[model samples]
Target: MSLVPTVHLPDDLAAALTRRLAATAPTEASAQVDRLIENYRGATPTAAPVLRDAGDAAAYAAYRMPATYAAARSALAELRARTGAWTPRAHLDLGGGTGAARWAVADTWPGESGPRGTVLDWSAAALDLGRALAADASAPSVRATTWTRAPLSGAPELPAADLVTVSYVLGELTPGDRASLVDAAAGAARAGGVVLVAEPGTPEGYARVIAARGRLVAAGFRVLAPCPHSGPCPVTGTDWCHFAARVPRSALHRQVKGGTLPYEDEKFSYVAAVRPDGAGTPPAPAANRVVRHPQTRKGQVLLDLCAAAGDLTRTTVTKRHGPLYRAARDARWGAPWPPDDQPDGVPDSGGPDREGAV
Candidate 1:
């Protein structure tokens, strides 16, 4: 079975985002959707100004919420699996647009006791929508999440929590601002807490994540997920490592995008780190991270792995490799692989070389 946790929004939250969607006139809603995406894609130092109007906010909810929710859930799934958690009692959702992170967390850990949290964002309208959705949640802990309106950079204060997530917010800030935000989020994480950061999967996005990862380590945090080691990154050049999650489009989403595909693949890059000192022991580091989706052929499988040596290695397994080949065939993106020398026990080159034939 797939280990990734599925993202299922509470019924009321979905209803809140879509409740007003049907009232929109197609042409006008379409234009709002276009502008929202354009502005967000090119955004720097701001993402809420364009979403001020209610229609635009609704359109954005239709356009981005599902994908963002899926990405957050996927990142958190990887983080929890690699580093066991004490079961967070509280969360701080930094720039959690429409409170997607909160929803994802609730779904990821739907235990008897849910997590109470806070959502901080610059947009009042976005918060309003979030509050409306949250009000529908049956769990008191989730419904009680506080929404704070404040600047993302140089903010006076942030909530204290067991988990802090800065999701889909880095794209709106300058490089320096992104770094500053990471620092702030790191500080907000209570000792022994976990901090998760996620961004688009573009090369530029990867650069932002890489820079933040370096800074987080410098700040004395332990790197987790999407990276198996604490040293410098291994993937380089045009081959940036990212993972993809499929998000099923809502009816409103289909209308807004003017597409028929039921789902869209959201490619994202993320980092989950912890304040290692007081943080409880983490799971033993995996031997390698399957950075890319495995490619399977008739009797062979090609895998791109980020090994513990901090380098990307392309290792191919053929039927002759026996059990290793079977495991490689089933490995998905963001999963881990065991350490095995090049077929016949060859030392791993760690260079950009073709996977040796099985």
Candidate 2:
């Protein structure tokens, strides 16, 4: 249940980024890299431009692409494990950057041939860069990706797709625009198809995801992950639901971002929902969700669990539990808690915010 995807910035893309950085003086490239970091920290739809030129775009690929790919990859794994043998034939990415979601999909969807996918974004440079990066990708889906330039707010109607992704792009939009983007994504999906949305793991990011979830539920889609029974998000108070994906960064990543952590944990909140008509049958549920990492101590392990009975509580496993204690000891962040257990009745993780069948 703990899915950690292997992400290396694609070879062709890495060469391009290196060339772009080399084209600039070291100081200039570093400054552009610095700006990418700063603008990313402060950017909104109307903010100062971030991905302006080759160097700017390269810096973006360096600092952001790995984490973006990791989050989407993790969410897709969770959805697929539940759905079983489902493979999307067509994909549409609204405001997808550098086609990261396409790569994530190519990794998870288990088709003999990859799906056809399109990436729509406002940055012509980003689209162009996306193409170069994916131009000779090994995955047919990434190679077949079409990058289109479109305004996020007033983009044209989307093509119907088997899978749709809107990742890390909602925070840049206004409230109205976020809702509109969600509507467009929801409308574009075929019945029983999936729509995956990911954002930063901050409280505000979770708030945006919560709003989008409401939109999806109202639009007749059912929650697929992070909730066993979607009656309501049973998690209340200041804590919000989110997940983490750890990804390895390349040498270029160190150069652009400075310092040297070989990897970074990308924290994100995502909702994967299926349109009622197309979702097929619901899968059997995991009995508990590991809402927090297990705390291992001498002869005992402590776990924060969201149970099948609709409660979030702490469970202590001592050496007496043997295998169970070892399993709890080795459990990772964002995995199904005690994966083998089956729920007897309804399941709940968050509180008072959603409604679905038990």
Number of the top candidate by TM-score? 1
TM-score of each: 0.87, 0.85
The 10 consecutive residues of candidate 1 with the worst lDDT sum are 338-347
lDDT per residue for candidate 1 within 43-82, as digits (tens), equals: 4666345568667767777888888888888888877776
User: Where's the lowest-lDDT run of ten residues in candidate 2?
Assistant: 349-358
Q: How far is 149's C-alpha from truth in model 1 (Å)? A: 0.8
Residue pairs with colliding backbones in model 1 are none
Model 1 alpha-carbon drift over 4 Å, by segment? 1-13, 23-26, 278-280, 320-323, 338-358
Where does candidate 2 stray beyond 4 Å?
Answer: 1-26, 47-49, 154-156, 278-280, 319-322, 340-358
Tell me the whole-model lDDT of each prediction, alpha carbons only.
0.76, 0.74
Using lDDT as the measure, which candidate wins? 1
Cα lDDT, model 2, residue 152: 72
